[model samples]
Target: MNVQSKYSILVFNRENELFLPLTEFYYYQQKRINESSALSYLITLERFFSWLAKSSNYQGTRVKWSDSHMAIRTAVENYLIYQMGCKLRSKENFQYVIMTKKSPQTINHFLAAIKSFYKTALHLKLYEFQNPLVDADYSISIGSFSPTSIRENKPRLPKIAGTEIPSDSSYRSQSDSYFKLVANDWKPNIIADHDLPYIIYRAGSEIGWSLRDEVVIRMLFETGARINEILELTLGDYRQRINQYEIATLNKGSEKRRIKFLRFSQDTLKLLMRYVNGERKTYAHEKQTFTKLSDSEVIFLTRRGDPYNYNAFYSQWSKIITQAKIKMNIHKTRHWFVTNMIRNIYDTASDGGEIEMKKNELINYMKWKDPETIKVYEHYFNEALFREIHENMAKKMQEYEKEYLKKSHSSSEGEQLSSSVLQTKAILPTEEIEWINEFYKGME
Candidate 1:
């Protein structure tokens, strides 16, 4: 027999089956699967192979390329069951090994891959056994769904603990004090130059990341775009719309939408434009490869000029977060931006007693649907403003009372009314108090 035929026969014999070239079939199957899915299959197969190599059935000898088909199939089935049992016990903390959640989709995928392998072996005449993965029964009750079902049926709302009105002033004071404490406690040891974008870019570069990494980070922080959405961005996704940048792209699940970036993010946008126009354009021109440079080309690229993969970005981000000594994940930068922006909006509204047209336009541009979504910021704003107003009014009233007492030795009815008005306005709005009193027919 020729070298190719001999090698094929040996490969078939190793699995103890007859009639198939497993490696060739695997290559064909891989071509049908996406890169991500193919990688998952390869990982699973490696684990299975490792277990098989360590099994006592092999008798400390390597299984020949031409192994007994029935024996190989039985061994594989036993290994699968053992793995499932182990996984179930591990997930349930050993409390009940038989009552662990086993995903049908995962098991089905494993079975499918193994069945495909056996089919290929049979086609090549390398093995004579029936597909064991398909024949084996995997219908075992791993666990109860009671906990998950209960969680799904539970109501979603914050439970209020007390009847007392939560003073806006008190809330603001507490929030400010808490943020100040946290910020002070976790201050970075290495003082970064506050040149903003330049500092951020250099920090990213220091960690061996490309210019694209800096752009992605800035976009996440400034626009609050989810990480997956940022990865999906293409060169043509961004467009200049008057003073701001509008990014039209698909989100995680391929949901297409538009998001507007404020003028404050201009510097970051400019850097991205520079990188694309200067570096990206030049590289594509020099390479002159079959792939044409277009807006459809991925926005982010690796050092080698290839498209940036999500997994690679995540690994790098974890390391960077650790190095930076950030108490939260990188995604917290997005939360910080959203929270601060809402706080600013609330402050402006409280100061003016109404939302300005310009401020309203900006809020709309950000695509927030409900005013209540910004209520957290309002809570903080109300608390701070109320406290300040009350403290100032109280001090003024104390002065007025002292002056009146010195002149007349007692306050008149009018003086008492004025004092009452000041104190009443300090706590609740005049209109709200009057409405309440009217509704109650003068009840205290």
Candidate 2:
């Protein structure tokens, strides 16, 4: 097997069989798509090949070079079984081992990688036998009486000009709900409204984190920006626009264009400036490792003053959130941003125009080309939104009643120490007010 890779990528032929070509394809696709996504496709294919080699060995047989139709099918079945935490005898180690099943999202991604490989293999005529991954509309079998035979005799399906890859629902919704769970479980009572400040204090004070690390935490929670976008920023990128400080970085999408953030807090701006004008100056000058590394120039630097590694940054971030008792993925920050923004519209009882205006602002703020995809955030934490609105409405009603009762007294409080004042409110409750209270009770 000839394995070649520049980064952590694994592109190799297995026992002289070129079941996939990922290097060139990955590179080609990276230019057209996100680099992270391209790398994931390559890694998934590598794992699939490993599974195929192991599966073949488990059955006491070697994979054939020519007729891999059965091999592909069997390999996939074994891989799926293995993913379900089944005990399987490894051909490589010759010992029974537990095969840990991946998430539904990961499994689907792996399937896509295999499907794409087969599609390419068939197009290039890499093998004489049929590609098992072909759609049911096509035939890849030769003279035989079976489902395979039917496809063989049937005409091949026309290839579409373009294509590509949902299952994160259960996994993600759990975290979304956790973020909206508020402080019933929190010792300090960190609800949705106060989560930002609560976390900021913990990250900066309890952890005593470095300016760079603290800034990263702030950027994640405050702006809900992607890690890549934050890592791509520089000292020069932070610009002043009138009274506000905005940072323009490339947003996540096909276009990958820069978008300006106009909603960062003044304290966050000060911390960022402190890091840039103070510590960053001393730190940036001390870095001497990996002279050609892009991290050397990137704004968020490691203790060694090099650029942040994605895995390292993520691992450390997850640790921080866990230590702080924030029970969710960092991506919840993005969800928090959208979810709270929606809640704010109702908090102020905004009109159609104001509500629609905020949505438009969000479209530009998040760099969303299609507003439709952004609507998904609206649905997240919907139950929590309902609870919050209900609670606030109930409070407002109580305040209205107190205010009405206060008219019968000289004080704001109902502490006139007289039954006549209380009788005044009791005797003059409006029919409309009674109806409204009744409606609220029904809503509750």
Candidate 3:
């Protein structure tokens, strides 16, 4: 039999041995319109089965048909707790790991994924008993003294001239206003125009542009979605409306929500359209796609016309940012859009009443549940925009000091070395003591 047929047989055998009704559930998932999501669910369930078989807690004990639910739940909960602990300890070694520093969102995603798996396992009668894992509460302790302790333990680097000072307030204000302008300008345009986004794409392509990069940048700018939300978009998730686009899906924490894009540029829509029609369609025809690709049939494709992975997407985005002369990080682009939008709202509102009116107007306009979210973009308006100015100043000062030292040393070499050197050294004063002598103190 072929590899796929052999694999299917193995999976079937395992399913039967485990007494899991996984095949039917898998079929149900594949039948959903959002097949990508169905596939992810299946893959997660498959992992659950694999973990159940290998788990020390589950080994040798035959899962009674009635105890299946309890067995699966207990297995999943134990696995999640073990994984979370492993992640926390691994943080010291893998500092760049994104979720190393836990956030509410990160913890929630982890819990939700495990919770969903147990719920599905229970439904499928994978075990004989109700899932014990379901009864466990997800809790994390953020130590009260942790932040201050960490700060104390961390080594501080000497301040260098060119490095920008880390001022959170200033950065936030600037970023908030930058994107508002871009979004409002494109609000009146058709999404199919394809000019603006293409210009951005081409300009950014020196680093590299994949189909997903094009779609992501466009979506962020057009829809004002967060980077995580943009990354989550799949082909089946977006719906075109009369004047806007509606993205209906689960966000980071599996919370289903709808976000509306009022004025998607025609350019962005056309690029996405072309990617779906040309790139993704061709990949599906070739049948060389990965499991994720086959399941999602997403709009954005890799150069090989497969579904885009996060690492590859980030690498490409970093390259684009460098090529485009954009001094901001990838997430900064999202900030750029939001900041500009808020600024425009602030500017267009009536005088004196501007802040109050604009705040209320944006609440309705953007459907923001909390006005405090707007504070993230406030820095752009508060300061001047300059690149490497402080760094340059620092370098120049260091150079001047070096040149002065060189000149002083050269002059000293021409005279009686010890006396002249000491005199010349005194020309450029420093706080450090020149010499220490027990007997010479009174004479000096």
Candidate 4:
């Protein structure tokens, strides 16, 4: 469909017949899945389709794909060959750079996108083809194609055999696996323990901030919640439950869970209640963009009495971090919370005392999907935490030993002094002693 050099989505052709089903598939996911999660699928779909439109084998001087017959195996093979020879343009440091081929992860994304498209399209009866991506081991079904298990959800995508990859621009086939590119490893900057208090204190130092801002900062530290999760907290979560204060929140994954502030006392809850009763309404008074504060039920509001969006929250966070002069960011607070909890609990468990920290407990507290990801990515996942905790416990034990020795010396002197005092009291006149005691009581 070379109707134009550019592909107009509005104009349909046999080429579009190939692309439309995939567009519909991802669009359906965007509507159903969380928007943030769906964005990746949508981006990948567009990239794959755009490549298909431009690829020489797929679209070279072709008017209609529906008119010309192509087998699924031929389509997949041609696409894979094109990918190996593809040179991509990107801007880095204000300069353009051409990449020889896509990374392995990107190559895998293409496979996943096409596989999902074909599977979904076939199921909906939108179109049908012999899907070359499917292995004989698994039966494809549209009615129940979605996997429930985490393992099944993340099944390894089949890669195009290295033998099929083109060696040069001439399209000579290569039997080697030299074209694959690996994804960079994730390395998070660890946040220190004391950084949180300094940040919160600095946040409070700012003028025109009601308890709403303070609550936002404190709740983030207290719950180890993501910023979006705290921002989305509703007034309904603040309602009293069974004579106790509790807050329910939805995390990044859209999993709703309750946070009972046991670590933070009722006094902390009182600060929140105070905000609800008075400070929430007061935000509108100081805000230039003030409107009806009742419009949004979200707990955290901006100076405009509008809900705290990502931009507003990040801006406020940047100001606080700048004033605090700390190397930590917002997410580092979550890291700080978990790291300190694990370290402190481990330090307390010395000398055969039962360990209060548990993997399952951390998973539930942080509202993580599973233990594996947290282990692989979070603070407690590394042996560095164990080393830090062990060192902390050793220092605490030494301090305790010094205090015990000092107490023992004081006790010895006190025992002798007590004996002398008893002797002196025995020798004193009972009436005089009683009189002195009564005089002291009268003064109190």
Candidate 5:
């Protein structure tokens, strides 16, 4: 990756100069999409621009943001080809290798960014020529029906297939399917609800636990929110009296922003209060000691009191899972939350119309415009199915525990395992709740 590429895409040049074209394009995007989504599009543009700087066949050694239409067009095509794992026939192309491959969904995102960039450029009269991506292009087609994974018992979305298009004078004219890239065979990992308490217990453990990290974990599990949405939370957005936090997250595939309210459980609320009043304040003071402080109202902060970025939060989560010895991603918690919420909100024993009403309510809560998206979790639609799956999961978890113990016994040195890792029901005790109540009472 180019050093300049790491910077925000809003920086149009290596000299940190702003290019009016991209600035105008970004503002145009902001009008239609959320700020984060707009910024992501710009970030994609940055990556493409960085690749153009090094790639051969462009007229100049240095490609400016305001390069000619043909140059930019050719670069866009070549970049897509390169991302699809084709070698570029250029002298300077030897500087790079196809070690890492991009998924179809990722390439589609790149395509979207480039297309949007040129579209905006044309709209703003920055580019007089036709849009580069006006020709036939690659798009991922996730079919109507998804197949269930026998191993995980969850839906695995089908791979991306090329959209059959009539040949024309523009790009991808000949056998566009020949340039097929494998799409993401995405399988939603669902964490069993029985194991959730143990995960939360480990997250909030006294040893090596960061209260901020714990709060974020608990919030994700409880709210079924995307990590970015949760990270966007601020002190101003939080309503302590209502035990809710409101966030305006970008809804996928649309121009609208979804306003979501994350209602916290009583335990999570207590932990959040403790973090805000105690550890976070210390972090803020430490940050002030090193540098001039600004009145940033962002809720979750690093030890240095800087607001949590994705990479920093991911690193913290990595540490959390490593200590907990779990083979699950942070995203699995969302699946768990969503499935459980569905189970709770819609009882199968209820009338048919009531089910539809509850489903509509869930769709509204999740801020989903399309009802079909909820079909992915269709397996957990009923109480009977949920119970069966839960029972099977409990058995599987026991077998996994036994296998884990057997491996531990065979290790060079036998160490006693933490109950938070080995046990499924490691919830907080009555006295601990009493202690939390008393502690907050004194603070009040």
Candidate 6:
């Protein structure tokens, strides 16, 4: 029986035989994709292989030895059509049953996995034939279809087509439009500031509640850190005196490490210390006693004393929100923090220098390489601040005009200036104001 594992991905053929070539490819892809991602790719491969074994186009021949590109292309098209008409029963009890067609995005993802698999196989010399998908574009329009083949009234399925690969700039340009379309309607789900106390209370209110969940929730909102970053925290990362924690990243193959510090509230600091000294201590002690269990230094741990994985943390979060009667996801905590932080900036940043200072602080606290990333967070454009900016600019302009008029009155050019000012009627004429209004009207 095949059991899905996060540490490694396993693929089996229809005959329940181990598939080594694709399994090795999963390991080779570790630097780029995590084990969970690799498992998804392996599953795509497993389904394709299973289909290939039964496909009449190849007469039960292995895909690697199927030299005819036309036969392979036909089989792939048929497989996609098959997938479009199916749905999974469940993750644990896996089987594809008849359902409405899958989305184009999903089919494209499957194509990507299959393409990557073939590329790896070729690089590893596991396949003798040239990659059948070398010229395939995996776009909405995939291949040739007869006039009567597709139902005219229904949504058209993707047809396979051989097209030139898109340039990086062209792809990015297309992606920008897609991103804008998504961004137009998508707003971050954030917990309002007034509701946070109740939510926090609910997080820790349940009977047999783990202190770790409350600590994690508090830290996420206080530090505005990524969920993975919080989950990966260790004992040495925290500084109790400063109420701050250090986040360090060593890239997959890099020797150098980059570090950043994030501070939390004193209240959060107390909760963190409590979890570390109380609940975490118990889990660590249990882990030490169990020789079979690997000792992990992560601050958050499961009941079994194992370090908390993303899935485990998410599951815990789901239950907490359900109990709290809140609809917010865990990631929204970061959004809530950032959105409220920006609101604080609006409250305190009275001058340009102060605004810049707060901007830098935001960038540093978020540990974002690109300052532009802050735009992704939810923000309210303070109407009061906007009006204040226009008022300040008008005041400055008036002050400058007054000083200019005083200078002109005393200077030799005063006669010419005074005559021009008189003609202009206080240096801002009704006609000029009307012109400005007309320009704004054009804009409208």
- Model 3 regions lying over 4 Å from their true place: 1-78, 86-105, 124-126, 136-217, 225-259, 269-366, 374-444
Query: Per TM-score, what order, best first?
Result: 2, 6, 5, 4, 1, 3
lDDT of 3 by residue, 178-288 (tens): 001111110111122224445567766655565657777877766655555656556445543444345544432233454533345777777766666665666554543
After TM-score superposition, what is the CA distance of residue 229 in candidate 4 from its true location, in Å? 2.0
The Cα local distance difference test for each model comes to: 0.50, 0.55, 0.47, 0.52, 0.59, 0.58
Best by TM-score: 2
**Lowest-lDDT window of 10 residues in candidate 6?**
175-184
TM-score computed on alpha carbons, candidate 1: 0.41
Sort by lDDT, best first: what order?
5, 6, 2, 4, 1, 3
Best by lDDT: 5
TM-score of each: 0.41, 0.54, 0.40, 0.45, 0.47, 0.50
**Clash tally, candidates in order:** 26, 3, 41, 0, 0, 5
Better of 2 and 4 by TM-score: 2
lDDT of 1 by residue, 1-444 (tens): 644543211223335654234456545455553333443454455556556666625444544324665456545545545664322222211111121244222443354455556555666666666544333322324343333222111111211211122233322222100001111111111211234334444556778765667777777767756565677667555542444465665532223554543333677878777767665555543343213446567766665667666556766776666555454444455445655555566556656535555356545544443433444444555776798899999999999778667746576778877876787689898799889889899675
Task: Give the C-alpha lDDT of model 2.
Answer: 0.55
Model 2 clash pairs are 83-101, 139-151, 295-307
Decide which is better by lDDT, 1 or 4.
Answer: 4
Question: Which regions of candidate 1 deviate over 4 angstroms?
Answer: 1-208, 239-244, 252-254, 257-264, 279-293, 349-371, 376-444
Tens-digit per-residue lDDT, 1-444, candidate 5: 645532333456555777667677777776665455676677777777767666636764655556765666566556666655433233221212122344234554565667678777887888877665544443434333222212111111332211111222222222122222242343345445667756655754834778887788888887877777778666545632243444344333323343566666888877877777778778764433212223246677888868777667766776767677766556678778877877766646377688778878777776664466566666535545778899999998899778777767766333434533445335667688788889999998
